[model samples]
Target: MNRYLLAGAAAAALALGAGAANAQAKFDVKVGGDAYFEAGYVDQDVDSGLRSTEFRNRMRINIIPSAKADNGLEYGARMRLRANSGASNTRTTDADRAYIFAQGTFGQVRMGVSNSFNDETYVTASMDYLKLGAYDDVTAWINLPSSTAGTVTGNSILNPSIAPDANSTKIVYFSPRMAGLQLGASYTPRNDSSNTDISRSKPTGTLAGTSNGIYQDMVEVGANYNNTFGGVTVKASAGYMWGRAVDDVVGSNYKDLNAWQLGANVGYAGFTLGGSYIDYGKSGQNERTGVFTETTRNWTVGAQYTTGPIVVGANYKNGKDAGSLGTTGDRELQVYEIGVGYTVAPGLTLQAQYDYFDLDNDASAADDKGNVVLVRSILAF
Candidate 1:
């Protein structure tokens, strides 16, 4: 079946299931969303033009419809879309997210571009998960090319070593909760319009000759676990990713590019402490032939406390990268950040965060430092 068409059919089935419950009664639609303004500032020593104000951040709208069927089938789908892009803080867009799923004894099977199983693995039960502090550059860092071809060297300050692109369809299955452990997984096709395949590897001929097919093909997997003993709650997770480079003329230049991460969080009496570590392997590329093996790793420790309607948190992140990707510097980066968040009401949050980036190079020619600040508000239903 056509994937998009199949997804549509699934959504229709859910709507039908929900409507059947109202055949003998009246049903009302439930609607929700949030709109907010943001301001941001960046201090990069090299490129001053990137520094700006009130860069349009995000204007959001969301909706969901759900109903119980006479046959015991409960069905629903959540829809979200952005109305604008950029200006308020950093660059963000008004986009849409939709999902269709059915609940069963085993669990729930969701279809559409939703959160992948790999994504569920690292997030903890901490309040920061719902805040901007999640994946704050200062706390979580990785080693990757400066710009694909090794023109620069540093941590993934402005970007992540691996990030999912939009419209990337995934199938996620959530298992029944068992002693605080939840397992899940997702599979994505090698060729999808949303397949970004952005990677550190580049087409050798492009920089030196021509531009052709050069994209990364890959798969990812992860798991999540949480348990409570008495008054103490603990959460932990691990994940792995692997991909191949299709260099077109050069064909598959590398067989494997792999990475993994481990994280943990502990909470007690309205206070929580968290830490994590991530490493990207140096298994691919012919470093001997000028394509150097690059690796990145980092560790973070932070805490959060909540009182009444207010929550506050602060974190310290330390990052480092080694091996030269054709850069004259030591190929290392370090960063730190602190953040604060507040909950005004159920499902409504306001947050402000600031972080600094320091690119330390063994060579003197590279631009070695920068800073960033972000403030945001979100309404999730």
Candidate 2:
């Protein structure tokens, strides 16, 4: 059945009575965002040239203009400005998320530079201590070397989902939720292009042995479930992605992208247990002879408890990939973490976490292990 066939009144009713929270909200531009300041201390075996302590902070602002038609058709445009560049680069701000969206009885649609469906809605381990929602920030403290760990492995050990889309220019469709389940999909012409950038030429590999990470014509399909039964809450997500690798040159044979993600969570009385698994099966690897290749994957599981304004949590994450393709084998990263948070006031909180990490290299005996502690203050409005 055609979604447009559905009556606009029905859509308005589904969203709540016409007096809904954002009814015809287009008259005014809305602004909101978050900021965080973090201080970290690391003691690792590989901290030869790295400092034992560092401070980092990030800020973002979201500008959204939205309106609802008399027929209940809602339309909006959003731009998220970010000032996250570290001391390594210029302090210029950039808009990482810029998109336009429309919603009605037919569900919702988003176009422009935006994330894939999976990236926007993948479930994972309970980690309230982490910033916003990131799994690999710990890698920054370790300062792992590239020479020992090879190419296929990513920056973080926990691959929570397929993120190759990287917020490229794309179109996404979301189905109306039914019985606590929602479905979504996205299409990207090229994963490497974002914002105002445009490239009609085919991406081609230039190096002889290195694999091309760029992919074209990417597609993603995903689903999520969120419901409460009695005193227990359940949440889950699954997704798959595929794309064509860059055009190959002589001595280069790049594998197409094939990635998937699965995750779930169970919560009751402020206590939540969750985990996730992600796999990129030789995706974007140079399969030609003399170039090493291996499955890139990661998994994580953990639990957290929240009481009043305080929360505590712990989790384990393991990630592996064919690091440094020319290297003999894969590299592994294991992290055991514990953290706590205290809410000081509305939109403000303090958090601290401790992490024990172990790094194992398949190429040689340059194994490393260490501990990291981070303290952070967050403000959201």
Q: Each prediction's TM-score against the native? A: 0.71, 0.90
lDDT scores in order:
0.54, 0.80
RMSD to truth, every model: 6.7, 4.8
By TM-score, the best candidate is: 2
Q: Of the candidates shown, which would achieve the greatest lDDT relative to the real structure?
A: 2
Backbone clash numbers for all candidates listed: 11, 5
What candidate 2 gets wrong by more than 4 Å, as runs, is 1-26, 147-155, 248-251
For candidate 1, which ten residues in a row score worst on lDDT? Answer: 206-215
lDDT digits (tens) for residues 1-87 of candidate 2: 122322232344345523344553555589999999999999998766778898989999999988787767677889999996747
Backbone clashes counted, model 1: 11
